[model samples]
Target chain A: MAENLQDKAHELAKALRESDEFQALQALHEEVEEDDVASRMLSNFRKVQLDLQDKQMQGEQPTEEEISQAQKQFEMVQQHDVISRLMEEEQRMSTVIGDMNKIITEPLESLYGTPEDEQNQ
Target chain B: MAENLQDKAHELAKALRESDEFQALQALHEEVEEDDVASRMLSNFRKVQLDLQDKQMQGEQPTEEEISQAQKQFEMVQQHDVISRLMEEEQRMSTVIGDMNKIITEPLESLYGTPEDEQNQ
Candidate 1:
């Protein structure tokens, strides 16, 4: 029974991963919660974009100090406290939603079960 | 938005608690998991039942020592270690099941969502 339960758990996990619902939730989640890791990843991209915009506006080269400051800011944002909180919330929401599903399905089977069986010894 | 989210959480909880599935699951659970707290509560009841059954078979009254021994055994069973694990498993299973439902439902919306909108800022 324990082995069967474990197998069921794996099957369930696979079904969830391939599910359209999982994809949709993941997409929606991407919008709702931004990752510090990814945001940190794109720091260089942001710096390049900012540098380009600055050059376009001022027609002046950015100083080494300015570039250094921007890098520091990018690093700080990458590990921002808010980003950490968002990650936590993301994890919590996932657990909450999963629990809600179980609440919906498995519990109902007993209501329709026979009364004699209900009084199991 | 926080208030709305809180309200939704409450609604979800209420829906789950009152659900037919919840009732059925509760019943089924009663059969599978014997709680130590309740078992302790019914310790006296068990002693009475055993004493009555023994008297019927042996056609002899149970001695005070026999009753006391039975009570001690009942008390020990009431707080068995296995009951605690069952309680833990019950909680874990509830969370797992709820998570599965969310995986099944919310994620699908993104698969059907527009590609343009998918690239949200």
Candidate 2:
């Protein structure tokens, strides 16, 4: 039973991999990596993100200057056409996955029952 | 664009929810929740489980006695018919969702490229 479900999942992944949206995102991702300028820009943006995450984990808030710096880094990365498209595609993909999560957990939701505000959603 | 993908995801979730396997699991979950004996048994099992997780999070390894105690609690819960059925169903559902996650993450995996050994998987 588990093997069959896993097989089905692999098939689903293959189908999604072939999708235009996924393919486009993949192409853009590769493009970013191939361009030293764009890749460096992305790396810097990621560094800022990780630093903020690390600070939060340590119970420290990022200063206003740090926030502004991160914001500037994000805008700079967005200037690259391939990176811009990749970000948009990532957003679209995230939306679909997020929706799937809501559905996949429906049984749990029904069994435990959601809170009043969530139930309405 | 994002809305369309989200709508499609919702449709896919609806289809999964209507499947017989999902329905059986949901019914079993409700049955266990409604059974006083089974509910209490499962609660004890979960308490043991959380304690082990807490220990691990604190960089502590559970002693042999702790592991043995958790095993006893798990075995006790499995003796309950509804709880057993619910556990089986949860495993099945998790397998499907786990597969979906593999498919959903293909782009990220491609973009970052997994560690050399993990690439084969």
- Give the number of the best model, judged by TM-score: 2
lDDT per residue (tens digit) for residues B28-102 in model 2:
877877888888888788778989999987768899999999988888777767888888888887776666676
Query: On a 0 to 1 TM-score scale, where does candidate 2 land against the true structure?
Result: 0.63
* Runs in model 1 lying further than 4 Å from the true structure: A1-121, B29-96, B99-121
lDDT score of residue B35 within candidate 1: 62
DockQ of each candidate relative to the true complex: 0.04, 0.24
Model 2, runs deviating above 4 Å: A103-121, B1-24, B33-96, B115-121
Give Cα distance to truth, residue A33, candidate 1, Å.
13
Please list the C-alpha lDDT of all candidates, in the order they appear. 0.52, 0.73
Question: Residue-wise lDDT of candidate 2 within A44-94, one digit each (tens)?
Answer: 888899899999777688999999999998888788788888889888766
Error of 2 at B43 (Å): 8.1
Model no. 1, DockQ: 0.04
